[model samples]
Target: MLRYLSIIFCAATSFSIAAQGVVTLDSCRAMALGNNKEIKTAELKIKQAGYQRKEAAAAYLPSVDFEGAYTYNQKNLSLVDKDQLLPVKTFNPLTQNYEYELLVNPSTGQPVIVNGTPVPLQMALLPKDALTFNTHNVFAGAITVTQPIYMGGKIKAMNEITHFAQDLAISMHDSKVEDVIYNVDAAYWQVVSLKAKQRLAEGYVSLVESLDNDVKALVEQGVATRTTLLSVDVKLNEAQIALTKVNDGLVLSRMLLAQVCGMPINDQFTLADEDKETLAETTLRPATFNMDNVYAKRHDIHSLELAVKIFDQKAKVARSEMLPTIAAVGAYHAMNPNTYNGFANKFGFAFSVGAMVKIPIWHWGGLSNKYKAAVTEARMKQVELDDVREKVQLQVNQASFKYQEAYKTYDMTCKNLRVAEENLRMAQVAFKEGVSTSDEVLKAQTAWLAANSEKIDAEINVRLCDVYLSKVMGELKIY
Candidate 1:
């Protein structure tokens, strides 16, 4: 008993929520747009493109870099001894006296004499070693700044490409929004169509039931045969079955609509009732379309055009790679154990400024091939753009033709409905006056039901066609 009571309460709550208000087409569109993941992704892409543009622009600014390093050598650097000569005083035994001697010139290999006496000269070469790097720890640091003076227009091309990417992202976002709106409209109208059919099914069942009751009464009064009552019963049963199916279909259709609107699948809601006569009257009227403006407004066409521009910019960038680059460089360097001047354990600072040029001398034709590839890609993009334009024109023409056809069908069904209604009324009058059989009445009722169903289908088709036309023309307002 508790479980049953809980289920009943939940169902009542659902019904109360459903009865709060009707979900209009605009409301559904808003909900879908707010919750759709595709739209959110597109929005993120736009932000990403914005950052890319900034990154490309940053290439024009100066860049600063800092570097530091420390090292320990196994041994200090040393200079070996240099060859040299020195004069010496010596005693000559042949002279029997102490005398000063001159040193011999090493390169000339000749003895030197003083006062016409040949004196033996003695010389000695001294050996000395000097320590070049005595310190075990070395530290060096430098800060450098570089500014690009010329880059063969690569930066400009890249900036333009980023701009094109941003435009493409925005166009894609608009296209996604249009798609969401189209889906919502389709789901909303499907529910509306099913609801109309459900109502028609209910009315049909009621009609058959009333006829069955009248036939049973006449049979009991001996005014109608049992077979006539049995035939009415069969019609009533079939009509009830059809009503059941229609009701089930209407529930499912509503669920589908709710899902499309970003609502819970099981969430129940009513649709704002649209008057069929008003819809038919409004849609039956023909209006002229400006195809030229429609083509211009299409987001896909704009996106393709942007893609072509982006490709062209890429080609420019590729061509720029083959040209020379120029930049200005400035640096300040400081190091401990200053070894540049000598082996001194003191920190010293130095600064310098200069310009650099990098000319592409040889690359085995690689740069030329890359530029050619970029050009070919740009050409392909242009061809694709042309193809898209042609396709857009074809879509517009197809949608226009479909709309016209749907309107004609709706008009014909409306006339047929009127005829069917009149035929049913006449059949009922004849049956009451004993001129028509039960079978004739049943046939008339079936014809009326068929006509009603056809009219409903026709009306929905017209509405769908209108939506298609608007979407193809890029005039559907998603916001």
Candidate 2:
């Protein structure tokens, strides 16, 4: 029953304390990486590029397509408006030829002629109705297969471009991950820095409270004046106000950190470093200044390189448009009202195999101009890549220099903090021995607070510097 009560009490007080859970830098980085919208977008782009690459690869193989069409006509097809013909022919084996039979006049036993016309004795009738065709529903369908014989290098270049695009997408994702990690680190450390300052401010308030008491007691005994007491009171109030400000800043900083970690802004959590008196010394890694290595490690640089290659392949694709293209085609055709069989109302099937060649003869130099533009675009990308390389190199150098200088600043602040602590201790002892005034002791305490605050700032600065340096070098690790 007691344990259950304790659990309930703790749960109730957790949010009030604004310290419910503990999270480390590594956990924060992982959370941000998993939840960041920009990172997710980049990952989606990579997937899209992968599908595009597959599509380009499919171009290397044959494709089959099917089409079917139907039509209905209101009227039957007519071959002739009126037709009447009668003629007779018999084979004459004696002459090895056919001759027309003529109508004979029985009275004269000779061929009959009217108006210089020979009359046929026998004839075959061809009626107009026989020439009419049935035309109601017509159906046509075809199944075609096409394989690229030679596309003047367009297919190959396009395939290569897709590969480059996929690589570029991956590189862009890596770059985004680096940026996310850097931002999360900055926010996390800022909260930790402010937490430390809050503690320092509270300590300062306590020291001033003690001084005020001492001065008040002295005034009652006539050793200190009322003016001195008022001064101590003012200092105590200032220190308390400073502590309040620090607390407010800490709350906001924690909120920002939580947002970066993809958590609710109002969520309560404690950082691993928040309770520590000092941040651990950062392990300084040696930086390699070799640009080749830097270029290899930096995702943005790699992305740019890939962009250049993609453009080069695009230029090749454009040039291919001006070249001759060849393709192999095969089809199976089926149609009703088969002309292959004397216009019978039955479906007829036919298969054909052929090849198509397209030669770009003249388009007013359009294809040539397009190819030239593509080449120019490729060259422009190369120039941009070079320009970015110079800027990134400078950025790397600046970040490295600042990272080193931050350590030096931290060391100096560390020394000043120790000195300040000792100075305050000596001043307190001197005042208790009645050799120094309370004002001197108050001055020492204020110096100590400033020193501690500076140290905290310096420590946080060093951490941020490391994060920035790693990012600029494109070596920002996951943890």
Candidate 3:
């Protein structure tokens, strides 16, 4: 049992040493960016857009394709049917046309006829086999190259659209980065705030415990009643309970911050600001901003502008379908049984080059309607962008005002905390001298806790306000 206990103790101690680290804000932001699903998806979208742009650009170049086929025929092709015979003819000088040489009978002075046809003196015979042609096996193939000469500017517009699409994807990625930074900053500050409160709670509990001991001493000396001791005991119990609650809250807040950093929810980690008494505290200064510059730098606005450009290009593509299209085509063809050379029993090759043109006469208003719809969609996107720009302007102004107000509140809380600290000190001194009631001491302690808590909140609020104002002004960046 001792050996087993030793092993467990060593493992826990090693884990503690390994888990110790001061995680900075920049580190958390980097981890979140690396682990975020949205950021990875946005990266893939940018790559996809890049490939699509390349595809569009390829339309400007010629495309080559090949097709081939083979077939079998049952019989050969023939131009003539069966054997044939021809009569021999002789040319006569006195006559203009050729005269057939007719066979004359010995007893008849004229010609001999068989079945009402004259008999020629000589005839030549052609066999059926000589008229047959071999065409049983056939093969054909062609390789064609087509290049677009003109398409009413559709190709150019498509390429432009893809380029803008890539830009849009990049802008969206920037927007997601800003969102991630905002979330990390919020969770990080929450943990810091909770840590400060936890420390405050511990201090208050200790102070109350010391007072309880002093009151017990008073009771034993016969200078204070049991009623006074009971009251002090009750306040001590309340302070202990409050400390317990703050510790539990701090644990949960740490869990939230860990989750936001893309770490395991149950993992143990420390924040850089957790040990510090102040949170996100820095010198405050008045600031001025340029709305035009903010609008220009905003990722959403840039994405919307890209959307408008893409829609306009789509309108052009729709209109291109209504205009004339032209292409240059060249091809090489090869066929068996060589028909180009008297249907010989061999393969023959041929090359051809030509241009094609298409003119759209009518489409029953279909193409026209599509183009009009695209134009309307582009216009709508433009109007939405304008509206969002105005809203962003208002949002920046509001956030700026809130940011300044947070600093002012912080100043007031600081002064109040000082006053509460002084009052608590004075009350404790008077109570020790037996000149003040225990009730006054309790009130002073309570006031001190409230003031300290408010100051912590004010400091955190200032940090939050700064984050939001930077977000609205498009100043939050990944770096």
Candidate 4:
């Protein structure tokens, strides 16, 4: 028995140590923003867009390129060089003939062919077609730079478009942050709601246990039947079962809250009691925001507006494709034929600067099709902007109506809780005076528990819906 007591004491101590940490509302919000996967992804996208916008803005700057190459060539120079060929006379190793064929033979009708004798073969005329000019090996290097002289304002338009896109990315990041905030709020409120229900369940169990004791006392004094005492015991058992269910629900609610706050599942945390009290006292109401004003102010709406602007700039870039691209180019080079020679004797430098303008004479209507596509996409984005406006207004209206409905429900439930408490008090008094049955007292207790549960749910929904409505109006951060 002493060993068992020591084990129990150690377990209690461990539990207390594990459950010591607490999380406040502000801390939860900060951790969610820092650790939530969705928010982290949004921040990364914003950073990527920032770099892309910088790249687009840097398009007006000059660009420089360095190139080097080596080549080898072995071929004839020109067709007019006739003395470049050489002839030879050799022994008759294959045909055994000192043979010669001449067009103008003086002593015979055919060219003379003397077998096994020395012969003189004159230099033959070389084939004039096998010649080239630029045939020697050469190595060249050059550094060229080009600046955007004019691009029909396409570069500037693209820069403007990416600037707007960066703003849209930032707006999207803001929306993700808001979503994280809403999740934390809802999860924390759920935990609070379940805790309240658990308290009510425990209270019901206690009341039923007390009634069971009283009925047992009356039975011992010959004032109550055994059947009545048994009924009271059954009610006590049912209350205990309800209390167990509530405890399980509270544990599950706490786990959910931890998940939303991006904490480890095994990590124990207690929510701030003051925060729950403040949430219970907060009023539910719609913010004063006009639909027209919201369409201009909300990040989601503004992101789409910026999208339309980007498409407009894209259309300009597409139109610029029909015009010519002009730029100046210059280069210098050196050539050498000897393998051992360096840049001294075998070096020659040449430089020429010129403006090149390439005009597209015709295509199979490719340029026209691209320009049409750009125009179509731009108009489609315009329609999308209008759609976003309609959607935003609908969401705002729905959230506002829900806020009002929840507020009214919360108010009614508060009044009902008071009535339930009074009813339970009167039923207890009547039972003590021999004017109420055990069933009547049990019914009143059940009603009070239900009323308490409903009030807790209604109160939580009011605060939750208020946060939702504020998120819709983009006023959550202000709160």
Largest lDDT belongs to which candidate?
A: 2
Q: Write model 2 residue lDDT over 24-133, tens digit each, in one string.
A: 77777766765678877987898999999999999999999999999999987877788877697899899989999898999998899989998888888788889887
| Model 4: lDDT to the true structure | 0.75
Which sections of candidate 3 miss by over 4 Å?
1-20, 71-137, 283-288, 342-345
Report the C-alpha lDDT of model 4 over 1-479, residue by residue, as the tens digit. Answer: 24224434543443444357876666666656656788668767878888988898777887777888887657624547544554555456579876442334466655445684323346565565544344465667767767776786688888988899888887887877788889988888888887777777878998999899889888999999999998889889988988898888788878887777677765767777523433436754545567876776687888888888999899889877877777776655445532234323365666657677877668889987898999999999999889878888889888888888888887898899899999999999999999988888988998899888888888888888888887888777611
Every candidate's CA RMSD: 9.0, 6.4, 7.9, 11.8
Candidate 1 deviant stretches above 4 angstroms: 1-20, 72-130, 134-136, 274-290
Q: How many clashing residue pairs appear in each of the predictions shown? A: 0, 0, 0, 1
What's the CA error at residue 22 for candidate 1, in Å? 2.0
Off by over 4 Å in 2: 1-20, 86-89, 100-123, 285-288
**TM-score, each model?**
0.84, 0.91, 0.85, 0.80
2 or 3: which has the higher lDDT?
Answer: 2
Q: What value does the lDDT take at residue 389 in candidate 3?
A: 96
Decoy 3 TM-score against native = 0.85
Write the candidate numbers in order of decreasing lDDT.
Answer: 2, 3, 1, 4
Residue 85 lDDT in model 2?
A: 79
lDDT: the better of candidates 1 and 4: 1
Candidate 1 per-residue lDDT over residues 93-159, each given as its tens digit: 9998876676576788666657875555666655444434566888899999999999989999999
Residue pairs in steric clash, candidate 1?
none
Model 3 lDDT per residue over 244-326, tens place: 89888888887887777667888777777789876546666457788899999899999999999999999999999999999
> How does residue 410 of candidate 3 score in lDDT?
94
